[model samples]
Target: MASLLPFQDLNCFPNPHTAISNATDPINVGPTPSSRTCFPTLVPKLEPLDDLFEPQEQEQALGNIISTPNPENASANACAGIPQGVPMEDHVYSEFNRISQMFWAAFPDNVQQSGDDNVSNSDSRAIVPVPKENTQVSSVVVATRKRSSQRVKELVRVGDIRIEDERHHRAVVRRTRMVYDSLRILTPMEEKKSSDDSAKRKRPRGDTRAAAMLRYRGMWLNRDKRIVGAIPGIHVGDLFLYRMELLVVGLHCQTQAGIDYLPASMSPNKEPIATSVIVSGGYEDDIDDGDVIIYTGHGGQDAKHSKQVAHQKLEGGNLALERSMQYGVEVRVIRGIKHEGSASSSNKVYVYDGLYRIAACWFELGKSGFGVYKYKLLRIDGQEKLGSAILKHARLLRVDPIFSDSTSCFSLDISLNKENTPVRLFNDIDADDGPLHFEYLTRTSFPHFVFHQSGSATGCECVESCTDGCFCALKNGNEFPYNRNGILLRGKPVVFECGPFCRCPPHCQNRVTQKGMKVRLEVFRSRETATGWGVRSLDVIHAGAFICEYTGVVLTTGQAQILTMNGDSMVYPNRFPDRWAEWGDLSQIYPNYMRPSYPSIPPLDFALDVSTMRNVACYIRRSAAPNVFVQFVLYDHNNLMFPHLMLFAMETIPPLRELSLDYGVADDCTGKLLICN
Candidate 1:
């Protein structure tokens, strides 16, 4: 009988009697080899869910049907009964790719090395292929012994481990593309092998050839020079892509492209003024200010034009007696053309680089004290007026104001134009004491091509001489009172009323024994606008006295080096010039671009309006709302801090102008705000 408790092992003892054995017979070793199997009466099983059962009666006989010695064999048995559609290669590749991904994630930029001989083995490691077809990781690849890319041409198939390569075959793709482009380079017949390729011959030259070869930039240009085709979003290690866009193709004409959409050269992907603005005031908007340049119909009859007009205009036409730089005469394109064996006149220009050229048209000061002058202008190039230039078909117009009041007593620019115009655009602070050599580029004002360079044999007798769109200088010794074009015309930059009357710096010319005098100012600039930031936020300045200065230091190499040297080797006093001291390193370096005030001295703190100062800063002090007026005494014969700053004792007012540093024409002013900020 057994108690109702867990059973114990049965007691089995070795045989009580011991037996001896002779050498002839074998005997069992020290302990008996066969062990005893113990048996005990077991208790009755209970159902696991029974309420009456204790924890010991939990397990029941029907709870298990498991077979021993079968962990993996179960899968084999299961598969034997059912079907698994997954391809063996796909399964292996999937597993390997997952492992590779996890590996890289674990060691992003770190390399693993075992010992002292540490070297990278990542390149040699096999890459597992990623699926290409949308077939749910069932992509099939045929692996041959042929290896010709950045991929391994092998496969491994073990129980659960597998590996393959996934490379795009860039070299092969590039080679095929080169072959296609080469076909286009050959003449029409040279490319013929079979009649199948003949249909492509009718395709336009650069336009159709690109798409067939999968060259996107050229294709985009063919479709339209604006859109770029879709590309992989990642930009890592794409130097070859740049080569394809730039070197292989000659499509740099676009204003902007790539990530930032900046004009290829001039724009560096930053916000800048797009269009210029100009405001000409008249009561009921009737006055045109008689501007030398005006759009076909000005654009800024609204915003930004009113404040400037408010300052200069009153109910009557007369401006304030304290009007700053008002009533000036002309604009000078300093590099005037020399008439071929005739009296000098006729304001004509031509185009080569597609940019029109104008000569030095001077401004007479009439003893108006040099301070500051502001101007409004319109830039227009009409479709009917432009002939064959790139701008011929573009609707181009801009407006802006100009301010030029500098210290140099005078400035002259005579660089010639690509299209033999009378002048290029401008020369700098050098005096216009020397003679100029000018030439003609635009067709004569009349329809005849018997241009000034060759001159018309019939003069005014010619049917269309000086009639269509040009100004005629009496070249080839034609006649007196040379003919001219007017800037007020409906075309691209036409000149008006040019003669010997427009002299610059307006010395004592007020007595006026006037000979064809039309007053204006000539502009030379390296910037589009001299960006200004000061005590006040921007104010709507009337044309009275809006002023600012060039903040660049123009230094020669020697002088720059001296300034840049360590404190131990420096020569000049650290006490900076008043205008530029606060600006510090932001100040312009010399030889960079600005008129006068070079390294022999600090970059002038302020860039005066050329129209007003007319080289007055040679003696004036720097001012935001500057009160005092200055004059140019003379040159620094011995290069030193100017001998004496000459303050002008004058009770006169004059209008003047200056140039901006950007490539914008110096006189466009609508975009020209006095950035009082």
Candidate 2:
């Protein structure tokens, strides 16, 4: 499980499951002055009792620092110092109540009521004071609540996983994306802050990524159990931006080790077996040819000096591969490739290439002239197209769409010359026409709408472009919404962009979202029937790259509600998920950092009627974890109530990957398009 806790040694907590043995002795209750045989004390410390509390309740309950009686006096009754009239259970309960009161009083404003109703009602009850004789007794309860709370959350999150959901693929994929999105948002801010603080020592690169993974490690899926076959909900061609992401998804349980295996103790035959392997060109002797890989065994390298020092032995992963071959077991194969356009610190992207089996195994000398073990892994047949192959085809498509071999595109440009880059329409799934006929609209259609809030009429005076001190930049907390590379620095409640009335040029840096679509996208029928028609990019869309604006005819909430009652799809601005909040959350890294909050905008009563006149965003699918997010921008118009809904990439999206959004609606909630207020 070393992969499960990737940052354990790098300032993160120890192994997540390692119990804190320094905890004080448990409360031993002597038989209640009636029985001859003393009842064995069932201590909470010895049992896995943290799972007894609800996820939310554990956070509020575990925050309180409570002390327990010393282990030396464990043989005596807990109520030995209490008055004779009080029962043992009542006396112990009263003592806890008194301590809790003291804890809450220490930080009165920080108190959060427990989720359990019975626990919350105790605040109204009278608290019995500690006896004068017991005052000298030291508090012995250890600060193990942090570890318990983490375990509690892990169980709670795993319990929520549905094995039978049709959207299982989307569910797991989204969870991975959400965690990375938060990481992406924090890293840039951390780097910028470090650069400005010359007096402070600079943090090593990629520390934020490690910190984020550790902070939310409990919420990771597929870690509770290891499956030998294909991981349910994880599909071939799914791309991960980092190696840890593979751990998060349980694709490969090793953080750095190329091979992950089930130990002899875990295997049914009592023989270690290999489960998965990552081919990243780490060893020069290893060979990879599309469907087949000549994998290298781990060990024999001196990591401290970064070279081979000893000959390899068949004891660990090397032996496991031999056993897997004898058992005819399938192993998951993932290919890691260099990401030339990576925006994040990690320069490599990992692709899940489905399952493989060990065809043969032997020992050999390596390129470094040291003896090593080698295994031949041949890809199993009848799986989806290899992810690496799809990437190569995508590169060719971007270069010349017409020359690509596979027959899918029926129409070259669905926008009909509206957008700068043509949005291709493909339908190899079945004989279905494009989405219901709709007028091709590039901008939001507002009929004589005028809204003038405070500071809405003002415009920046930058002649060529806007920078740090420009009015537009100052409105965004003295930082431009995007960097010189046009990447978003952070998510804000509302981003002010250079408007038409501004003196800046049309191509100003501040007008990123205002520009028409740049990358090529396609509206195609998804192979997964549940998702229906979805949008996928034909080009690599980097993190924070402008995708498209949610454009259509605008309508009042009342009008939209009436139409919705008549069975019409209406996009509500408030219904869009507050995904940006997590994207900008700094509490994980800086507990005291009060994240910048912009002045609240007036209530948005407008809704876009994309049922008719619409853009490519109308086809994007809704997911709990979405790779694209809507950013509210005010540029085309002065109306604060009707801000343009611009969509941007939440991460570096690979080609042919379906784009999704967290449509901030409950699972039971019915149909509605995205909205962000």
Candidate 3:
């Protein structure tokens, strides 16, 4: 028979088998109980325990065991009346002890219960009633308790069980994972600085004078109407008045002593000692005091000296330099006044030297090895002296207008023949044809040539023969290219015109090219010679007479090379054959411009392409014995950088004679002529 006492009371027995054997002995029944008392007293009160098998259950179960006088005896008496053949509850008691050991091991400290007062120091225990009929049920209960105990041990080992609230524990774990996942490579401070810098750069700055000047720095007069230059109805004096302040605004030229000479005014105490001397050592050999001096806004580089002398280019300040390049454009020259006595009495001021005229201009390398623009200038006589002399000794002569109509294709002030010969276009091609497709560039597109105002020398009011005393005639060595019959000289390379600044009447003899076309011409098909079109004279043209000009887009050498390689047929080489040798060595005395070896391609050379958007000159065909020849002329002398192409009659021609030009033959590296059939 087994004890009917609760499982906790089994702790008092050394062995459940011993107790069962003693209960069967009649001597062990000293305090034998009646049937009702035995059952009720041996069975302890059954109270429901919490889900966790709370410490309170262990305390009450232990109290029942301690209240008994001899727990082992009571257990023996209690089981004395039980049925025989019931296996002793040793396994159940062993399992109960094992579960208790596991619980204590899982929670070595104190177990935390749910609700307000969570902590408890007492050990937890589980109690289950044994069924007298079945040992299998008890074995099942023991297995279930073992599994629950193992689960508790695993929970504690992995640290899933927390002493704090379960919700708070979970929240802390989630926060840790989030922080690890959201980590960034860059620190917070670095990211904020980068964002702030990006925002600052995106903000716009106001329109200021410095900003405006920088904006309009590289634009030309034709592109920007606001620019002051040789524009129609505008004078050179007006530019000086509007832009005098900007002349020295960005001047970078300075002396070795840190003294700048570009300013219109300077402090008397810091006056430069070498005011009259040229900064460049070799400049004095090529230039004289009266020889037009071009003032540069920036200093020139030593490496650029050869290029400047060869090209006759001078670099200077932007506004002043461009304005000074205009034909007959006059600019006042000033020098700092040196004070020998007390500095108080002597004030810094610019002493006006005289006015000078722009003769020629081009781009050249500067001291810093960067590309810079340069200008050539010629001194102009005072207006008062020249103006009075012209009025007294000059005589007005009958002169033809320089242009027939402003709306004509060849827009100039020249007069055309009144023969009424209708001009014709043969094999007419549209501008959008294959390989010739290009945008039409108007006169305004030629910004390098166009000027906002005329700056021609107005002081020269010569009405008749321009004498050597006349500054305008003196500029050309007192020899005009054209005669009274409008016949040009045979060997002239360029022709200068009397600009708007000249005091001479519109009929001045110096203004020949500006007088426009004078012969009747026609464009006709020439399929026989493989030439698309050709031009012929409608009327008889004598030798040395001015013909139409070959006009086209000006392109750099690199651009021209690209066009030629791409099979462009309208490209024409614009080279100065007579000056070619001089170009190789500009300084005859020094010979510094000559390089040790020639480059594969000249970087500064330019060309003209008339394949698309061409003028009537495109009709001219090539021939061995051509009647016309091409000549480079500075028709609009205001822009020295651009040279106009003019056609001259090489020989006398009858009416309807086909006008032709001898396009120079191409030669190979061996100097052998390579004729293209």
The candidate that wins on lDDT is: 2
RMSD of 1: 38.3
How would you encode candidate 1's per-residue C-alpha lDDT over 1-677 as one tens digit per residue? 11112112112211212111111121111113243332222121111111112222111210111111122233322211111453434321122333332121112122345464223243222112221122111121111121222222122111122222212222222222333232233212222423384475333332123222332112111111111111111011111111122212212211111111112111111111011111112112222222122111111111322211111111010111101001111111001111111111222111111111111111111111211111222112221221112112111100111122333312222223321211212324444422122221111111122122222222222232333222222321121111121111010111122122222222221111112112222233222223221111011111111122121223334654554443211111221223221111111111252322322332322221221112211112223223222221111121122211222111111122121111111234312322211
TM-score order, best first, reads 2, 3, 1
What's the C-alpha lDDT at position 210 in model 3?
18
Ordered by lDDT, highest first, the candidates read 2, 3, 1
State every prediction's TM-score relative to the real structure.
Answer: 0.14, 0.63, 0.31
**Number of the top candidate by TM-score?**
2
Per-residue error at 633 for model 3, in Å? 1.6
Using lDDT as the measure, name the better of candidate 1 and candidate 3. Answer: 3
* RMSD per model, one decimal: 38.3, 18.6, 48.7
RMSD of 2: 18.6
Better candidate by TM-score, 1 or 2 = 2
Candidates in order have lDDT scores of 0.20, 0.59, 0.33
lDDT string for model 3 (108-198, tens) is 2333544553333333211122342432211111110123221111110011223333334233222221121111111121234356544
